[model samples]
Target: MIVTIAGAGHMARGIGNRTLAGGHTLRLYDRTRAKADELAASLGQAASGADVAAVDEGAVAGSDVVVLALPFPAGREVAAAWAGALEGKVVVDISNPVDFSTFDSLVVEPGTSAAEQIAAAAPGARVVKAFNTTFAGPLVTGEVAGRPLDVFVAGDDEAAKRTVSELVSSAGLRPLDVGPLRRARELEGFQFLHMASQERLGLNWSSGIAILP
Candidate 1:
């Protein structure tokens, strides 16, 4: 499986490392070509950098899955630009849509989510909402102590969710299916609280949301 990631930021690098380690080919694209090149260097032979427009659409064309690891606004733009190219492919939305200014709530309005908005923009693609609740540092590390990090996944399509779940598992994380697309509202809302808690409690990025039996 060839996995293409749109951003070379923390999240994209984390996912790319996991995907490449899992034996899949990885293509990464970023506005900063240097960042992509640096990441590809870190990832070795399985990873390479390319132009955003051409690489994004080309990855969708050649790969089974495409991960939009960018911020919400950027993800939307990419989805719109690659709408036709993303048809029949599983698009994973890992954005939280949080208002960084206040860190109080989601940038998306009530009853809607970033993932749903991306889905709306790319009607041809199957969108799955996931990875928003976890911090990038933990995602890259894959665990805190000895316990595997839990990744919550939600999507309109069960098959798409399954595909994402498999990727999560492949990355050495536990993927929990929280329900359908609408549940993304809950996930995003939960992320808002989680972010607030991190600041309020003065916890580092190492802090994570864990579900115990």
Candidate 2:
């Protein structure tokens, strides 16, 4: 699969690592071209056999899947901007709408989530809520404490969900199909508590939330 990831931040690195490890071609884009180039080079070094490159925004339309690794607001803005380009693509939203200052509640209105807002912005895209519960640190290796990370997936389209699930599994993580896209509400809520508990639990953003069989 050809995967395009926006933003060259920590989450982008983590997800990019997994994407390359899954043997998929990766194209990276960021507002600052230099950042994207740097990330692309770094990922290429880590996975030498993988096909990867830093590309401009215009190249994003060619991707089979596009992962919006930006924050909630930026994700929504970009989704709106690229709504036409994202049509029929599996677009993954991995953001939690938490207010960083308070860290006690989400920024989005009640009864909705970042994934839902992003979906509405890009009506033609197949939006899926995933990776919000997984931190950047653990995502790089796709595991924690000798166990695979469980990626919670929610999407309205069955095939889109399967695509993401396959990618997650290919990267050596467990993909749990929680339900339809609306279930993003609970996933976002659950991740908020997980984020808040990090400091209290001394997890240092390294913990992984797992569901045992």
Candidate 3:
């Protein structure tokens, strides 16, 4: 499968690492070309023989899945800007809309999540909320403390959710389908608390949330 990830931040690199490990082709895009190129090179070095490259944002057209590894506002903006292009495509929103300055609450309005907003913006796209609860550090390895990371997936489209779940499994992680897109409200809220507790728990943002059977 071909995966296109936007944004060249830590989350982008982490997800790109897993995508390559899963043997899927990875195409990275960032507003700043240098950042994308740098991340692509870094991921390539870590995953030898991996198929990865830095490409223009337009390249998302050919991707099987397009990951918005960006922040809340940017994710929504990109979704809207590329709405037409994203039609019939599976779009993943992995942003946690926490208020960084306060770190006490989410930035989005009550009852709605960043993923929902992005979904509203890209009406035609199969928007799925995933990877929001997993921090970048643990995502790179897809595990923590010898346990696989649990990626909670929520979307209205069954086929799109299945596609994302398969990708999560292929990357050696667990995918938990937590109902429809509205479930994103809880996922975002859950991750907000997880992010808030990081410092108190002294997790160093390296913790992974796993569901034990």
Candidate 4:
């Protein structure tokens, strides 16, 4: 599958590396073209390996799956803008809208979540809430605790969830479908605690929340 990651930050690097490791073609895009170019090169140098190339906004239309690896509000903006191009494509929302200043609450409304809001913005796009709980550190290896990283997935469309599930599994990670998109409320809520505890415990970004079965 061809996966296009629409960011050039740490999350983008993590997701891009894993997608490449999964043997999927990757196209990267960022507001700053140079950042995207540098990221693509940093992942690897092989043409077909991981160090593919930076793509433009137009390239997103051709991608099978588009992962919005940006921050909270930014992800929503990009999603809305690309709504037309993302028709029927699996759109992954990996953002946790935490109020960094307060650290006690999220930026979203009481009930809605970033995924849900993004879904609202792009009604035609298949929006899935995932990877928001996973940090960039562990995503590098796509694993934690000697096991694959557990990706919690939530989306209204079962087929979209399945597509993301397959992508997660293919990237050597575990996918946990937590039901419809409404469940994203809890997923986002839980990650706020996870993010808050990151620096508090000085875990050095090594923390991974696992659901032991």
Candidate 5:
């Protein structure tokens, strides 16, 4: 599958590397063309990068999926910008809308979530929420304590969620279906608490969330 990721940050690069390793083509875009170019260069020919607006709609025009690996606000903005271009495409939202200043809460309004917001912004785009729980480092390396990482996915569309689940598994991670898009509130809220705990407890970015058997 061809996956176009809008953002060339650590999260974007990590996901792009995994997508490439999974035998999928990747097109990475960022506000800064140089950052995208640098990332594409590092990943070789299987991956290419460009400015978000410069990313030909053709690149994503026939892609199996497109990932919004951006921060919350940017993700929303990009989703809005690409809404018309992304019709009939599965859009994955891997963002947690946390209030960084508070370090313990989501920035989203009380009743909605980042995923839902993105979904609303691109109504024709099938938005699936996943990868918000896993940090960038673990996603790139594909292991934590020698075990494959676990990725939880949620979305209103079952097929879309399954597609993302397959992508997660192909990237060498365990995929757990965590219910519908409404559940994203929990996921983002959990991330807020986790980030706070990491800072308050000094646990470092190497930490991750996992379900116990």
Candidate 6:
């Protein structure tokens, strides 16, 4: 599979490693070309690193899955700008739109969510909400606490959800299909607490949420 990640920061690096490790070719795009080149270089030969390269944003047109590893508002803009290109493709929205100044509430309207807002902007794309609950630390290894972290997937399209689920499993993590896309409301809210917990309890970004027996 050709996976395109549209960011050059931590989340992109971690997710890029997982994708290359999964044996999928990767195309990375970032406003700063050096960051993407640096990330691809860091993956090294062990991950078939040669298969990954820094590409133009237009390269997303050829990918099977396009990950919007960006903030909520930026993701909305990309979704709108690339709506036609994203048609029938799995577009992963991994943003948590919390009001960082207060962290007490979401920046989205009461009834909708970040993922929903992005979906609205990209009507032609199959939008799926995932990875927001998983912090950047554990994603580097795709595990935490000696256990696989659970990735809650929410999307209206069943086939699209399954595609993301398979990608999650291939990366050695657990994918929990939470429900339709609107369930992203709860996923985002729940992860807001998880993010707050990291700072509140001094977990040092080492914690992850899971569903256990």
Clashes of each: 0, 0, 0, 0, 0, 0
Please provide, for model 3 over 1-213, each residue's C-alpha lDDT reduced to its tens digit, 9 standing for 90 to 100.
999999999999889988988899999999999999999999999988999999998898999999999999999999999999999999999998899999989999989989889999999999999999989999878998999899999999999999999999999999999999999999999888988898899889998776789
Pitting candidate 3 against candidate 4, the one with the higher lDDT is 3
- Once model 2 is optimally superposed onto the true structure by TM-score, how far is the C-alpha of residue 61 displaced, in angstroms? 1.7
Candidate 3 off by > 4 Å: none
> CA shift at 32, candidate 4, in angstroms?
0.7
> Which candidate wins on lDDT?
2
lDDT of 2 by residue, 129-164 (tens): 989999999988888989999999999999999999
What is the TM-score of each predicted model, taking all chains together? 0.91, 0.98, 0.98, 0.96, 0.92, 0.96
Clashing pairs in 3: none
lDDT of 6 at 102: 94
lDDT of 6 by residue, 55-107 (tens): 98889889999999998799899899999999888999999999898988889
For model 5, residues 91-140, the per-residue Cα lDDT tens digits are 99999898888775788997789999999998899999998989888877
List of clashing residue pairs for candidate 4: none
What would the per-residue lDDT of candidate 4 be over residues 1-213, giving only the tens digit for each residue?
A: 888999999999888888888888889999899999899888866335453679899988888889999999999999899889988889999999999999999999989899999998888999999999888999899989899999999998899899899989999999999999989999999989888887778877767888999
Candidate lDDT scores, in order, read 0.82, 0.94, 0.93, 0.89, 0.83, 0.88
Cα error, candidate 2, residue 207 (Å): 0.5
Candidate 6 — which residues are off by over 4 angstroms?
45-50
What pairs collide in candidate 1? none
The parts of candidate 4 lying over 4 Å away from their true place are 46-48
- For candidate 3, the per-residue lDDT at 193 reads 90
* lDDT per residue as tens, model 1, 1-213: 667888888888777777765666678777676777777777774434422222434556887788899998999999999999888889999898889998878899999999889999999899998888888787666787668888889998999999989888987888999999889999989888888888678988776687876
TM-score of 6: 0.96
By summed lDDT, which 10 consecutive residues of candidate 2 come out lowest? Answer: 202-211
